[model samples]
Target chain A: MKQIEDANQEALRRMLAADPVLVDVLPAAQVIPELTDRMILHAGPPIDWERMCGPMQGAVMGIAVFEGWAPDLETAANMAAEGAFEFHPNHHFDAVGPMTGMTTLSQPVMIVENRTFGNRAYCTINEGLGKVMRFGGNDDEVLKRLAWLRDVLGPAMGKALGAGDGLPLKSLVARGLSMGDEMHQRNVACSGLTLRGLSPAMAETANDTHDLAEALAFVAGNDQFFLNIAMAMGKAIMDPVRGIEGSSLVTAMSRNGTDFGIRVSGTGDTWFTAPVEMPEGLYFPGFTEKDANPDMGDSTIVETIGLGGFAMGAAPAVAGFVGAGAASGAANFTRTMGEITVGENPEWTIPALDYLGVPTGIDIRLVVETGLAPSINTGIAHKEPGVGQVGAGVVRAPMGCFRQALETFAESVGVS
Target chain B: MSETKVNQFLKTPVKVVNIGLEGFAKELEQQGVTVVQVDWAPPAGGDPKLADLLSKLGT
Candidate 1:
């Protein structure tokens, strides 16, 4: 009991020490990696896009056109089908994308720099669920939205962010907690705060009222506009504690459209992975389990840093989408998460826990011993291609991944 | 918040939190509500008597 208590205390200290700031964000094309034509970053299992379920293939084709790699969806489809384009999971790049969080060479990304640790991570903008190319749909609407994000939204946000002295996400998350936002499904508070921070820069850059109107409306309409900032902030916080000798803490937890992976401080950069599963929850009309994609994207960073589902009690509106007894579930999830974590986040505290800090970092060893893999509440991608979002739900990281990570950590620390 | 479901937990009242409120665990303590923060961990399992205890609390 003493050992457990000591470990828990130590965990809290590490979390409280985490002070992450987002300094810069950009695209993967700017940061080079050894990516080949045969690899595409799918979030779950490796699906052969050429022979993929329709939606995945469609997304592949759409991204090709969006990248100008292919002139049209048909050509993109043929190119992927003909084995010209390779597939890889986003994890390989130290990046996380949103649902169908697809990034071509052209997609603008928020380059999150952990100012404290001097490490960086990346994630693309939220594609706002459904029939979106990131889930493998290749329709004109998907292409147009992609075009707008690339040509307008990205640049606009970039300029606004630069002008606003850069958004301080940790503070925003702290405020969001008070206003009934877990900074995941209910981002209203954070979004409002983010816009307040960035709108001045946005106003300054626009040449006309129309541009200003567009920018303001964009921020107003999208509740999840703050996700990129939160992701960057999470990257900043987690990066500080990475490579902590003798520490069994989780540094990263993310999914490419293909697999769920985690990186631990003690384990270095290796990703322990498991097959991704669908979120179980309420679905939009005409969508069901068949249409849901396995969980994808880097949003898990929110949960990893101890917000999102762990803070769900603050955002009961999300209860409609996940399951019954959401408030109780949220508190329980946060409490259970505390068992596997190193500490509570001093800055990103949760009020429902009676001002208790949010569960900060995950430890692979505890996961194995407790058989309690981290629970993530996520948006479900369409299972078949082109369907978009089917539902929202919760899932557990596979025990196998944690077991593998523990084995690797044991070998590294000579604990075995 | 359903009364039927609330009544079903005839054990110690399961505290819940909504809108930045304290959780059921803390609330039960203040009201002298017969709630204990049981070991929710698996294996040996949660408090074995909570079921009977809750039934009594309900009465």
Candidate 2:
């Protein structure tokens, strides 16, 4: 018994010690290649960000003007068309961007470095879903909002976060599960708790009454803001176990405009992919399947690590957006998901099971046997060429991808 | 029947959830309710919502 416990501890330690990064990450201009408006950086694999359809493209254009790379939308468009600037993906830079998933040179991002493994990951703030830049619309209002986020909100949160002790995202995620937040669609309580945790620091650096009030309201209004913390934490926890010999654990799952890709623990960065499809679920007013974009973005990594839609019981309200009885099904889903995983997340946990750890480290072999793929909550972009976002919903990672991953992993490990 | 009336059929204590899962049906029978789970796949071009749970259990 003691030996088994020790083995678990060692495995966990090794997982925590992998690929961690430590640094303050600013926007793309400060740390990444120049982002042109025409360059569309989709998740999973390399695709042109500019060629992306709908709200996603709009978001990229918005990021360009905010970065001062272009004086106006037309200039941004011209630069992209003429290749005046380079377009790189958020994933390539060890970062994940939200919808339209655009990260530009000047934007500030959360720089969480795993001191143990020395691997780093970055992600920008959530644009609150509706009318946000990542969804692909480049309107005047979207650009203005981007400017405010960079100039005011980003710096304020950075100072508050910097002055305080390193924010322990793992604890917040556990608390979120207890308080009706799946850490995806319904982060109302978690967002409040996060803002409250940083309140003292924010108050000290706020400088004036107006700035403080605005910052509080911004955090208060966005329910899904805690998503980035979940993403970064997931990245941190999973980075350690990558490239483990004979391990069939799935390391990362994400989607580009063209395909869905996943990396396995046994293989180093080899992506198994499948054609993308639209997520099936309830939509907002006047939006139909016709308006929804195919799966896109790295947010699904949150689910792969067992937080987002997987813990639906944590956020019952998501049923309204995804499906009825999602709370019960979500619990069953996560519970079954645990059956398919090698172990539980050490640092992050869900409070529903008297503080049971969130299921972590998806095993491809287990998924093949159980016939259950990971469930993801996602924002739907319009299917049409240039329409923005149509709605949001839940989806399952296709089983074929996992089957292929399992077969390939079995071969590599010399197993029948 | 109206949608509300149709929903009322499910509110009764002796109700059946017809989803082609025999295990669930047998379990329901153990609770003293008459449940006959059957593989009643609805024909094509039908209202899926009405046909899915009702047709399988409807005597």
Candidate 3:
């Protein structure tokens, strides 16, 4: 048993030691091996279109039109109803997306490689905050932006990234934490940093000056530009820790609009899920609880790797979004999360903790024992598709899932 | 600035001496982490049957 724990610790070490490099940007079909036509990769565990929440369904419809499989919204909706598409989770394919988190053959994704572990992870490029397809916005404007991302931003980024072996994301994330960006709700600083990192490459490689300027400008204007990269980094780092027999650490935590789910390291690819919880959040003007969708997205992969809410103490500005309403309360929340995690990530230090590493590995056993499920800070999408973002807030991964994982893990360890 | 000590929990065997968040401690206990309770009944005897107990429970 002690040896098992040691193995788990080693797996976690390798995960934390990962230096994910931003390698390229390409269409999902090009990067993700199994992503074929007629397949849509949504968040969390698998579900058929019939069971998908409104936002996810909406995103899928947008992608259908974007792929030219359907010419209009009405036809796309009918195609979805008729089960013309195969829906799988981003987790199933080593990919993730924010909100409804559906990735299609045409959607552009960032490719990040773990320098130490030699594995790669993918996340669709963020569609920049409002009325985007990932949140179920299937309107023309929404589809247009996604097309631009697919055509312009993706290629420019691919060239910029290929200009070097790739930028090291580990140090960038650590620096973001110190600069008051939790890499979840508040990526203002990190996005700016990304622009700085890519500008030279973009400048050097872009054939057209206007395209380079537009791409740099687009990344600069969008605060969440760093989020997809961060999620890929999280996936790149955490994927190596999955399936270590006898280890109790959580390798993944995410939600499709309908359910919140987690995968444990020792448990392999099996998911422990609970009903998605509504967030206690600050709403945008004219939007309230009713407008907010249940928690969703592969974005919580950030928390699974101990950024997001676990590093909130470093990004006090995220307090309002966290329902804490103040910097000190956010800091306390981060400290409390420490109780459920195995240890600090020595590399990803938080300034508020006086350079202490953010809480790293979430041990399902410890989470169940501590009665504290992992905390997540996330963007709240509209309950209906196409309404875009409604607000942002804090949520706890339901304790029930962790409890179930503990029971199974206990049984595996022969602890009756 | 003085050097901050590494978090002791990282080095020692897992154990939690919980003060107010007993639900947290209970989950940890269920998961095989060592948890020691602080015998607290709250400042004012907290809610009675407010099956809205999640609110009454400390976060």
Which one wins on DockQ?
1
Question: Residue A400 error for model 3, in Å?
Answer: 1.4
Candidate 2 residue runs with Cα over 4 Å from true position = A1-25, A29-42, A49-51, A70-85, A324-326, A346-351, A384-387, B1-59
- Using all chains and alpha carbons, the TM-scores for the candidates as numbered come to 0.80, 0.79, 0.88
Sequence-dependent TM-score of model 2: 0.79
**Among all candidates shown, the one with the greatest lDDT:** 3
Interface Cα RMSD, each model: 15.5, 17.3, 11.9
RMSD of each: 9.3, 9.7, 9.7
lDDT of 1: 0.66
Better of 2 and 3 by TM-score: 3
Tell me the tens digit of each residue's lDDT in model 3 across A1-416: 57456857887787777889888888899878788888888888777778788888888888898899899878988999998888899988889888888788878889999988889999988888878877778999998888888889899999988988888888888789889988999999889988999889888998998877788889999999999899998999999998887788889998998878888888789998888999888888899998888998999999888899988898998887657677778777778788878788888888777888888888775565456667889888899977888788988898778766766766666554
Higher-TM-score candidate among 1 and 2? 1
Instruction: Estimate, for each residue in A70-184, the C-alpha lDDT of model 2 and write its tens digit.
Output: 7877777667667665665566667776555776656677776676666667777776766666666667777777777788888788888778665656556667777777776
Best by TM-score: 3
> Candidate 3 chain A — worst ten consecutive residues by lDDT sum?
A364-373
Better of 2 and 3 by lDDT: 3
- Residue B32 displacement (Å), model 2: 9.3
